[model samples]
Target chain A: MKLKLTTLALGAVMAAGPVMADLVFPSLSYRTGPYAAGGIPFADGYADYFTLLNERDGGIGGVMTKLIECETGYNTEKGVECYESTKGEGALVYQPLSTGITYQLIPKVTADNIPLHTMGYGRTSAANGEVFSNVFNYPANYWNGASGVVNYLLESNGGDLKGKKIALVYHNSAYGKEPIRTLEELSAKHGFELMALPVDHPGQEQKSQWLQIRRERPDFVTMWGWGVMNQVAIQEAANIRFPMENFIGVWWSGAEHDVMSAGDAADGYKALTFHNVGRDFPVFHHIQKYVVDTGKAAGAGDQIGTVLYNRGMYAAMLAAEAAKTAQGIHGTADINAAMMRDGMEALEINEAKMADLGMPNFGPSFNVSCENHGGPGLVGVTQWDASSKTWSLISDFKPTDGDVIGALVAEDSGAYAAENKITPNCN
Target chain B: MPDQFLFATEVFINGLMAGVLYALVALGFVLIYKASGIFNYAQGVMALFAAMTLVGIMNGQVPFSHIINAVFGTEIHHFGWHVPAFLAIILTVGVMVGFAWLVQRLVMRHLVGQEPIILFMATIGLAYFLEGVSDLMWGSEIKKLDVGLPQGGSFWIEDMTAGLGSENFYGFFIDNLDMVATIVAALLVVGLVLFSQYTKQGRAMRAVADDHQAALSVGISLNFIWVLVWSVAGFVALVAGIMWGTKSGVQFSLSLIALKALPVLMLGGFTSIPGAIVGGLIIGVGEKMFEFWIGPLVGGATENWFAYVLALLFLVFRPQGLFGEKIIERV
Candidate 1:
């Protein structure tokens, strides 16, 4: 009885040990709802990457990182609620992952002095950090994706795309409508006919759109779709016997789930990507050993190399690197949200850094500055091989039409600054 | 023929095919509303659950594996055996039947004499609950549902009709899956009509739907009839799920198809199966035709609201709906 009492007392004391102060990154995830299929793998990826860092590297700069996951169900209102609730938990950065939610949280995060990273999807003008200081969309944006698609087509046609009829079958929402302006500008520059087809939300029925596609027979079809919309569009494209090689989709539309349903017919479907494809990275090996093998995986461990999973892991890596930068800049391991923002603004990702992080050539090297939150806008192209059930990067990370994109970004951000009655300045 | 005219005709045919699918989804609502006064908002979620259950059984996936693994710290995901699609579908039907019985026992029986709004609210609550339960059971990943149904455009029809159009026009592109859905929906409607008109249990169901108190006084068990109606609705939901799941990968969005059926229900009236069909056809063709015609002028994407607007007009003009029984109350 005396020995048992002593053990109990020791166990109680150990169990009630001091809580460690860590860098908090709030992941506004949607693991259930209409978009849950896409959300699950991504959320899993994000959490798993942080877990990898915790297990493998003992966290960034010897300080542990805590990911506070709040379910948003892909709803804007719930996303706001998540932000409001988790913002007080010492969160250093926010990655909402949804454009609708990102748009809502922009002002809120700015007000709270937390850095918001939208990655590839959000307000393109936020790339103009002069107007929107708190928001950052690096490596690529929708305009970059649109320019990439056009660039790939131009390359295929031997640098000439005049008289080519390209159709844009897009989701009828802000996220989908984003590329229209860029494509329209590209059409004027390259002399290609651009037709925009809008598919309603939860795009289950798209017979009419596909039927029109059949009738018109555009030279190439570029889709800006998400979730069920992507699957249905791919299936419909397959059904109409559209040449799979001629069909291209945004990164959001290119995933294993989107084309797997169509079987072999989805072969050769192309999508514009900003990062490398597949599980060839050295970091994945470490992740497998530390995260999956240890049963600390954020998901089923089956999504380790999947596209969205890799994207999520990439996002987490960027956040970690930024945190490391903050630690270096502040001369302290412990960093606050404001310090994180400064670090993000000063962050630079190069080939050497990526190689050191074990994700050599995983993505393009770029620098984020006070004036430019978005990266070099370099994009790559990927092709789906249905038989092998894999996506292979077929094109190198190449520059987009920065002249047109820059002008548009400046114009839009300028208008935004004017409307908000704010002085646009790097200071 | 002019290319524009040929395109319009193609759109009309596709619209008819699309209507068959809409009617298939709405049929479940009509069945439940006819048998009971309660409008089941969970009908779409039922379809999602049924599809996920079917896929899970076919793939030999362990149900609630995510939760089980989380709690036990184990990594058991599958059963190491894949069930044949035919048997898996049968098993799924059995599960849905069990679900119907559970819903009747746990939910409907308690709300027997409740107001219509209360029952409706109960179904809305059931929708969220079933959605969460389905996600927990299936792991919330998009699953491909292939019951060996034919897919892609009908090549024979495309080839045969290509000559009838302008050289630029390829042909009428009709999906083989849509064709299968139409046939299945037709067979289902015929079978339902025959069962309700001929079988003794079906007669009991109709009698109960007519006047629950009167049917109870005449030896018909309200509990059994409600369970039967729910089971039939569950079967309808399964069929709709299979069709839509095959068209699009089975995912959480499968539950939102119920929203599409609402306008169908409002236009068809909640009590008539045939009305559901006609209403579905009208809405489908109207929306498609309107989108094909006036959508471009208005910047396209008119399919979402066109059906609701037409249904609203119907509600204002014909509250009982076409083919619906007109209610008469004596003061």
Candidate 2:
């Protein structure tokens, strides 16, 4: 109890003051824990992008964006405390990095009338803006990622997934299990045998899991792992000599930090991604000049080119763009969290906008609508070439089967709305 | 062997391999509990620190870069020279020894006469301190530590065992890293036993374990013995760190494996080395077999808690653990 209170007080100290001049974007960060391998890069990228905006463009719409990182260490309780402490400080939006935290924040943010950008993670049904009201998982969600992985597999096997055996070895938590429903739906739709294998939390010991896979002989293994789990899974996959080509991971498991441990053995491992990897984009040049070269970067500036780093930057860019849109809509420089929520509802990042933002086709361009907070659920596939030690985008961004996923989203969100006595508030 | 039996044998072999890794951690706990009568909860965190330090040294990363960066607003990452694996390990060992000395001087020495529970809590405090220090120093990014340890599955073993199962079963899939770990663990146990049985310092350690008060009466320095055992435990942690760090990249979850060792310690007596080893093997094999056979019926993923449950059951029957001396209540 003392520790919790102390952490809350510490979170208060770290939060941006409830000042009018700065747009406080409280980052629920975890730069010191099990998932720090992932969280550090993401937090760095998120902070650095805001730093870049402040330096390069003088903030979004002439208002300073204070990206105060409240260290939660990926603990859900700490995350909730961080939310409660910082929501008073004009927090424009919340990006609870962990899905577990996102789950906890969804209701809280709704009550607080603040917007949350879960971004490619969190509850897939939260994409239904009509029910969630304040929660947003724009660009893509886990359902999109799952469908994308299946779509890639179907395309790889000449568009027919009949009589195929696919296994999902996922982390046994909310974040890891987020895609089960979608995968199950896709399997039934495509006539594939879906075997769900839940790896225990942290997922280091998977000798028995692979043994079962060896016995069952699943044609393709789709991993939804994170942290040390990713490396361990890759190592175990390599140990089982599961064809690297046949095994794929979600975007969370696709980073260099995960596969580098396996070295050459992880050569042909593929993963589903919504954005392009590498430091070739124009925005990266600006980030290098404005953040890294200026020596004001949060983490090792040289690590700017990794997969998750890019994703983090993309998330920050989206948030900033939403803030800009809110400013434009409200016709005020100092827009509040409510206005920011409105701006998030009106977010649109097309090719022209991406180019204007100095990132030309860096990722799949999508728009968030009033009823659909999740943009056109588009995702691409990337393969890791250990020889070159880089990820290359292998396919065009394909839209998820929204006809199927949309129905599930509506059903799930309807259930949530009924449970919470929340009337659909679409405008 | 029939296909079903062959698969079970394969699972058992994998379990034994995992047990060796667990024993490596529990061995450190037993060493400390025996010598100082303090349950070092920070033992796992010690392994994380050792691995982080080793990786930091090898990569030539600037220590405390996070703090240094936060204070100065500078983005310096590396000193830019890769030290060889052998040299890095040696330097890391030096750091661990220095850490042991520091703990003795600062934390452990102050709480020298504290109750066992108090000392245990202090170690937990030490664990958090070391974790923060490690994160700040290494910059919290997971670094792949490759000390040139052999990895992946052994083709030789796989090919040799192919005919043991049905055509569908493509032999056993044991990690070659696990194989290397088993050999290293065997060597470590032997070295520890030989040193304790033969060397004067080791004899002093054994004496301290026997009775700290009696050893002190017979001209042994309790502080010196405590320091020596801690130093030995640090060495054991480093070896475990290297094995685990190489298997899965050195990250914070590397510390949680210490939790796994707790059940092993409970099943084995806290003061018994051989008991730690046997208890680790039993927990490992038991969990794996249970998960493989009964896990599916209960929705799988049983490896996480099965060991703890088994350990609890073991304690109900044998309170002093399998190889531990029978405990007698003073009342």
Candidate 3:
């Protein structure tokens, strides 16, 4: 009887062993509350991608990967609470998703020695790895998006925007305000007239702003909006008969839901992006077969090919690659948060690696180093085909004006370093 | 006319249309507050719930499919049959009426004799509860709501007024949706006025609003009247929801439109329906004008707070609002 009890105890312990995962990636997701529409698919994609890796390749570096999702509701306080509560779970990295939460977590992650991947959103200056040692916004950042819009316009306008008028309808928050400074500098360089229009949070009411747009009649209108604001602005633009082709939004504003409500009126609307959209890649088939078909999707299995889903999957793929790099660097499958940070700093993404992972030309091929955590800030443009309900990349992931971005990054990061009393050294 | 004057004229016209939309939301709040001395904080959530229900019914989405799938490991999403917009709307009204009855039985009955603050707090609780329930029922994804309402710019108006302004001005830009909202709001107001003046239940509601004790003494069932008023408010919310949801896709942010209605309520007086209309129009026009003329001087986005400042000034100068009942004391 004692031997039988011993065997039972061992079985119980083995049953609980999978609960303590080898690698933990805490997803600060906002699957509830005001931003849930955007948050749901992204969270689903993030979790499903990791599930795919585990089901297909037995996780990163032959050890199983675990994703711990905590709902933040896109609120800063809730995001911080989620981070604090989940940081003790041996969290390898955090993708807070919200720029407000990113600002709050930058110092916290640095203090805790956990790597933070803000992706396309967050403080653009965090690109300076010398000042922000733990935070990584690789592949592309917001400055690149702003410059990318200008470059696309320049190409369309026959390489001259000297006399063109551009209006920026931006969310009156840090995330929306991010592109203004860069756009201002670019406007000065390219000699295009720039007008700034601020839309408050939860921007449901915008009669005055749209009326102003209708009155002023800017040659081009670029929006830095998200959530309900994106749909509302697009509808209002359609209402004012704003030429949909001339209106461009950042990646956050260019999702399936944003233009679906406006129907065919939103056709030809443009948006800047950092990654390829649609489910044409081979990885999605594996995800469908392994994760979704097995009834293990993080959300409804319907979110497979959406823009936000693809972006979320891309984020997870980058995280997994960084983990693989970490394992290669330390020569061990078992690594910690500090090792993850080092791995993120030394990571690289080339075309061959992307194709090997079945995500060829999925994103720009960029490298992260000790001094540059943001990679070469390459950006592309995508236009919506309302009839097909799809977003196709219209421009290649081309180079942004590096000289201007470098100067702005140096100025912003230098100020940040002075404020925090941190030495500007990659070491 | 000069280009600047024509632009201001266009802003004014748009502001009036925007006010009508705000007033539509305020009408729901006014009805509840006038009948029961309780300020219904859940008015916005009611609109959100109604919109979600309408969309869910129209799309043939299985309610709580997300939860069901999660618990039972099922893959159910839709019923594979779409309900027409008219039938879906009728079904939604029935659901909202049922909801009204439930609220009266489960919530308002328990707090019948409570203080106004207590009743208001209960509504605050109801708001959150309803929001969660709506999310569970419809799933929180942003769904497109189309009841065949007109959208896009009114090219007729643009063409008619194209010659009124300078060459740069492309005529007064007006949305077709806003024009429909104006006509619908006018008809609603007229219908409400005739109902309260002619119908027996409407008279009972007004009597209850005047003196609850007196109305009870006259053999009026307070519970029935409360449910009736709530049902009417629910219908109003549905209309508001359809208008706003059709403009901006049905989502959680639809609940925040109640914040915009608060200034309208304060300016128009919580007990008066006509006051709600006038207040909505004034607040809308004032904010738009201020944002246009003065927002550029300051930073833009003054529309969010400008209404409150105008309402505050009204409060300081005339506490009872434009059409609110004037209080008197016998002491």
Candidate 4:
């Protein structure tokens, strides 16, 4: 009893000191693995953005934001370890780029009052406003990405999604399963037939998959793959005489590295673009002027404006915006987790402000709320042109079906909570 | 039922194409195993590295841009010395030869009398080390390897009555590259058979293959034979890499497919050239056919296990393999 009393007294004393002014980030980076092709650039871009913030803006609100990188290597266990290790250092938010890790950490982040930003991945149902309170998949979910691609195909084939056969060749994982629930729903609603093809992980050999495609002859094929698998799928599809324009990839499937692997054959392949593209934007210009030109950039020259880099920059933008909002509420950037949560829900990136911020193609502005974690589901389609070695935006932002997503989010978040054995904080 | 049969035929032809690709990979394994008992597990990695080098050189991503510029009197990013396709192919073959020579000198020479398993483990180590080294050299991003193979199928086989069926059964289409690979593989097989039968060096290699001890006792320099065999294996691996790299764009996972050749070796005799080619074709065609007929019934990923399962069954019936010499040990 005397020892317990002494321990309690020490804890109380420790709690009395002023919390250190720090913004800790739990980086879910995969630097060494198959997915490292995608993961390395993303981590580098995320890290560089934080470093730029510290150097250019004198930190977020004059208090430095510490970017703590704990490599997940794209494994779920390492992601949890990184989260647990960084949460104690006063973590502001967690952005697990992996769907598996996002599902694992949702309950923990919610219970611990740390919001997770799962951009373009994770539980498609998490896009529901009421079901997922602390989790946000802004820009769009997989379903939104799928819808954007389907819509692009519809527009290309004379502007209608009725009575079409859409095939989905996907890696058979949770990441691959994400768009299916939504795509099936869309198929049912729009009178389109959906053919699902599952490719096991590391999708290297896919001749049979392409042969099946040749036999079935689906009107369009959208792929959900990463790393070498993406290139292999494109190559196989090309070999089978599949029309390149009809093949659409998810945001993950659409990278310069992925296209480069297929060379000129992947010229007309289209994919969903959630954020700005090309290095001509003002923010990119700033990065070039301040970071690259001044020798502060972390990546190679050829890697600039790639898919992963833009995703990382967007993630950094969200974090800084949340910090700015938290400063507005708490009157300091060195706010606690609760303040960060509040800031995350209250951010408003208007179109005019986005343009002023040097992002002209920065989709739509959105704001989250206490009950609604995911902001607006807006997406645009982009296509690669091999001759120029650049991606050109082919469509404007189209609003995704939020109602459909809300129902899924409700069903999925409940499933996620139950599977992981956690209570929902819906109350 | 008719549609299913047509689909089955379609799947079979498709499998043959896939088999050709797998055979190309297995040929590399057979060539190395025939020359040296050690299975060069890093053949797939060698292919990936070779393809990466090709793409890197073509795209001006290689360093020495200033030197290339100085030599040509113009600033070039990569080896901006765009030689013709045949020259590029020749240079790649040279690279593989150099790689083989280096490996023979640095790694194989030291493990002369070591256990076979130890050498195999060394190759595995070499595989990972090469993967890391390749990534570091060529930036771990996915790159396109376009050796200017024909893109899509050209000739449309429309005469349905020409086959062993009715008007509904049309001749299947073939990609131009697939046809080229099949032709090239056939030519290489014939060329290699003639070389092994006709040339003195080829006879020396066969002597080495027959029995390393006898070959050594008959005044044959073991080191020279070993290096020669490795160089030949390296040539085979380079050709296999170019074909497969042309097919799949030569990323890191392509090396993983090299592991699939193990089961092929088990089905074919480990040391038989014809066994490797035929075994690769059988495994390839068998897996594709099985996946087509029964894949959807069992979670639709039978492509991953079908080849291994087929080889396992063959092992059950024929313990020494189809072409492997049956062992008769005397105590």
Candidate 5:
């Protein structure tokens, strides 16, 4: 009784008071915007996974998970507002899900001692853990995705691309431009002629670019598009009779909405994937039983299993596993932001662990270390079977060329470090 | 060089097609401005809302499903009854007509004597309000709008133009949807011209555009005419929305395409229907052909600025647009 009284007195003396019982995770969501088609599924997936964990396992290590989503509408300013307001609620980590918002929160989260997870996007150089210690983009980054696409292409072409002409049609934004330098480097190394074509923002019109494609007749054409841009590009490619087999896109361009409109013409259109495409995983059964079946879902219950929805689940799995890892390191279930950051650094999710978690092969299995925020960048290519309206994995989970991409990562992170006067304390 | 010119010809042809679409949206602006003297900036958002409503009604989905779920704590989405395309379109036109009436009653009724600049700002605000309401009603997910329009390239056109280019060159590529949009847009133009010239209501609208005071004095109820014009604009918005929402999935960017109509209005006089079409064609074809010829020479992506640059240059030479009334300013 005397010890409890002493603790209560100490807690009363402090203004902020006692630590919360729940682990806080702030989701920067954009459910209403120009990119709402893409954003809605991802947000639903993220929220549903956390809810599933809470409903099934009672959260990570028996602590209730608290997800307070403040809508960003995919705008950078609104993202910052959500961050500023929610960071004080003991937010252990943040996933902005937007490249522009991720960049804005990177510096602020560092100062606030919070970890920012950009996942597959934002600045590609954030893969270097030393310069971006407080941020993590584990499993993959844009450069890794770019190399993975090229590697799949190389393997498909029987390992030689000496005189192949490759064209990259990308969105005119930082998200789209992230892969250009890496693609250029790969082009030089492989002796493939690279042509970069940019479609303006929102990209509703693409007559000239496709006309150029008709004229140039590039051997391979890759795309970096989102929302309506992807569907329009697919339709245009079919219009020009461009072989869907030779046409590919990054992960963002692959989803149900993109292909459903193009109908049968989208057959054989390929894209990169960091996780399994279908809802074959055991975790989904629980999501159906606990969340959708219970009518506790955030969006349409039918959208429980989709491309971007699965991606959200993959991201939440990473975050939850990192929390478990952080709790193991700190020897306490009541983990804070700093503890979660260290936990993310030491986190690992192998095949066995995923199997144990009831989501065998649902996502890429990788280990995060102090020097590398982005884990082994393994991505597979998936093709759309328009008739059946499904995407099937066309390639094994292939690792990107670390030697070429790593050197670029170092050069970029080094430049960023110098510009920001950051000291690298990487082990 | 000869091969380059061959590609250039295709580019020019494609641009004219794109311009037809731009003109299609511009027609909505011309219809409303000529009758009411109010520049309707919400025309693009109106197109998106109409498409979303059409999709929702066709799918038998509930209106304000998101809001209802939030407020009532109940989960109800679709009614599980599919609507035929023709009936759904008719229902959507009715909804748009109701929206026109609401605008006439609630907002425009209050601001009847406001300046043109004020009215323009009001329309801008209306755009935001309409966008938000549509999102709330239909839920802002990207929806696939299929009214059974033919998609993909026309093989007949390709075969016809196959021998026109070198054997190495592929045949000319043309989307069947774009062809439909062009033919429909041409019919709309003809229908509008006939209505405006032959119908007494059209002559009354023309008189209003000529002089509002005189039109009001000449036994015309300005309120009724305004309502008629807005309903007509809403119909035009529906057509533009169908063409655009079909081309690109019905989403938020559909509204931004309305901005393209502004420069069209600048190129063609805002008050002239013919000018809107001509201006839209000029801007559309001009940007595409310019991007084709000079884009690579200057590293590409000139389409964004080329239309505005053309409009700016043309405006510098003539303060009044090509078909605008000559201004007589008194010092």
Candidate 6:
């Protein structure tokens, strides 16, 4: 009887040992290519935050996070290859920086039961919690950004946006188009005139776009550009003597590298922000202590709390919180794709926790749910000061107009379903 | 004046600057074609490689070391070296020369007397291969490159021309780098002309250009001349790369300007030194003026296609190009 009991106890110990599984996270880094200048900081922040979490708190519930990166070189085909190779290694979520690649992989990720964290990009319509069950665009979508720009312009002119002529110089891709449909809708509702000007991929030269702006003489210019397009637009606008105050860029357009080359000329440009500015945040102090001070920083030491970096930190925070929540329920470190998804859906980074984590003006108080995947719609506006080489937030917390955004999201998702021959499973 | 008019002038100037850069790239294309019958699509990638190499060397980082570290999960910072500007320039020349010699020894030497189109395709393949190898060697991150060149506007010219009030009537502004590029390009063209017309080897190159079969029969070593032409092209690429890489910093898109040069070749007859120079200036100046005067009236951004449209029109009148040998190919 004693021998049998000892053998049973040994078997139970073996079973408990197998339960402590580490979570694997794969990163598709576009640290090269035309967009690398912007992509690298975001990636660094994302990775650094995870490292900090592991270092400071011994990982999420003792389930160590491992980051395996595959350089896509900003090519869609290469991005797909990276996804295929990493997915089998137990990838829980994907954050494709490119809209084109995100669109290509959404179906595959959905079929594979993996969630895609397209943070600030990908299908704008995926903002609808009902249609895209496996995707999330926390904070806001491109349509929200468009509305934010329009709203800002309206406010700039003392709250009446009627009869305004707005020109959009955007990259000709899904990422660029995401805002156009919303702009068109808003223009019709507010009696503003919208002109769409498309720039080709890897946009470097824009002599033509500015020329058109000169001709059209639009009251405000909203740029949905990326990579080199941002600088090109700013330079062209400066040369044309376009009033810089009237120019606004999307969230992706506001980076130091984009405007640094054009110094002074890029002043007065405003861009929307889905996350709080990290420059003055206490989290940056922690980053300095934990990452930069330790010489584990990924980029130039100075780029620790840039806008992209802050967004990356937010993403990491969401993922980590989810992991913690999942461990609380499961009572073990071992996690699978399903548990990661549940953790992601249960994230609630409120102000108290944010303050405790050293982030002030960080963002809203909300929890993700299975039926509502867009974690929050919090956004703000930041203006570029050439003198300081810094972006200062100028507006209070402004969530996306959910009423209008929801309708558009539903409409877009409907169109996507029809085209792809998939039935809407909103229920 | 109307806002459109003001806007057009700005776009025109921007277009002109872009066109000038494109012409500089085309000059390298013309050099090789003038001496050898081969059309090199690798010219752009060659420029990319040269610029990247210079940046790497200046930073005190070896190319292979960066590649090895990058592939093996090691974070490699740039060498952080502050080599003297002049030394960096000289070292870049040596690197280009070595690369040209390797190409001649390994690839170009094997494909003598091949069809011009086939040679062109081979260079295209070389372009792809070089692009991949470059990314592998230098893990793609845009670096801040300061080669001690003057940047921004020229106050001297602006002040000198202030009396005319051209600054008010048209307010034409020229960048200091533009002035430097124009001056450098002129000096290089003159040097090439003197080399080809005065030197015996240059004459041999011209003789080979005139008749490859006859030149070979007369014991002009085709292999030696091919190597020389390639080396000259490499040197030209280095100069062009420096000017461009310095202007934009050593990035991948610097090579895409190769496509922009296609129009210059069409305008300048690919075999004439004067043609290349003249073609570059015309395309540059013309695109700017067109974007300034006509761009706003039509749609504002005439620069994107202005060069291509101009080249297409020029090509219609001169199929062989402005300086190309007018071959009467009749069966």
Candidate 6, position B53, lDDT: 79
Name every residue pair that clashes in candidate 1: none
DockQ of each candidate relative to the true complex: 0.81, 0.73, 0.82, 0.48, 0.69, 0.25
Candidate 5: tens digits of C-alpha lDDT, residues A209-230: 8888888989999998987789
Return the lDDT, model 2, position B66: 68
Model 6: runs farther than 4 Å from truth? A1-20, A215-217, A278-303, A326-332, A421-427, B1-17, B52-91, B105-139, B144-191, B211-228, B242-249, B263-322, B326-331
**On residues B1-331, what C-alpha lDDT tens digit does candidate 1 reach at each position?**
7888888988988888898899999999999999998889999999999999999999999999988988998879999999999999999999999999999999999998999999999999999999989988987889999999999988998898888867987877788988999899999999999999999999999998899999999999999999999999999999999999999989999999988898888899889999999989898898999999998899989998999999999999999887677889999
Best by DockQ: 3
- Rank the candidate models, highest TM-score first: 1, 3, 2, 5, 4, 6
Instruction: Show the colliding residue pairs in model 3.
Output: none
- Give the TM-score, chain B only, in order for the candidates: 0.98, 0.97, 0.98, 0.88, 0.96, 0.90
Q: What's the true lDDT of residue B102 in model 3?
A: 96
Instruction: After the best TM-score superposition of candidate 2, give how far the Cα of residue B40 lies from its true spot, in angstroms.
Output: 0.4
lDDT tens readout by residue for model 1, A168-244 = 99999889999999999999999999999999998998988888888888999999999999999999999998999
Least well predicted 10-residue stretch by lDDT in candidate 1 chain B? B165-174
Instruction: Give the alpha-carbon lDDT of every model.
Output: 0.92, 0.89, 0.92, 0.76, 0.87, 0.75
Q: Is candidate 1 or candidate 2 better by TM-score?
A: 1
lDDT of 5 by residue, B81-129 (tens): 9999899999999999999988988888788889988888989999999
State the TM-score for model 1: 0.97
TM-score per prediction, in order, is: 0.97, 0.96, 0.96, 0.88, 0.95, 0.82
Model 3 alpha-carbon miss at residue B253, Å:
1.0
lDDT of 3 at B260: 91
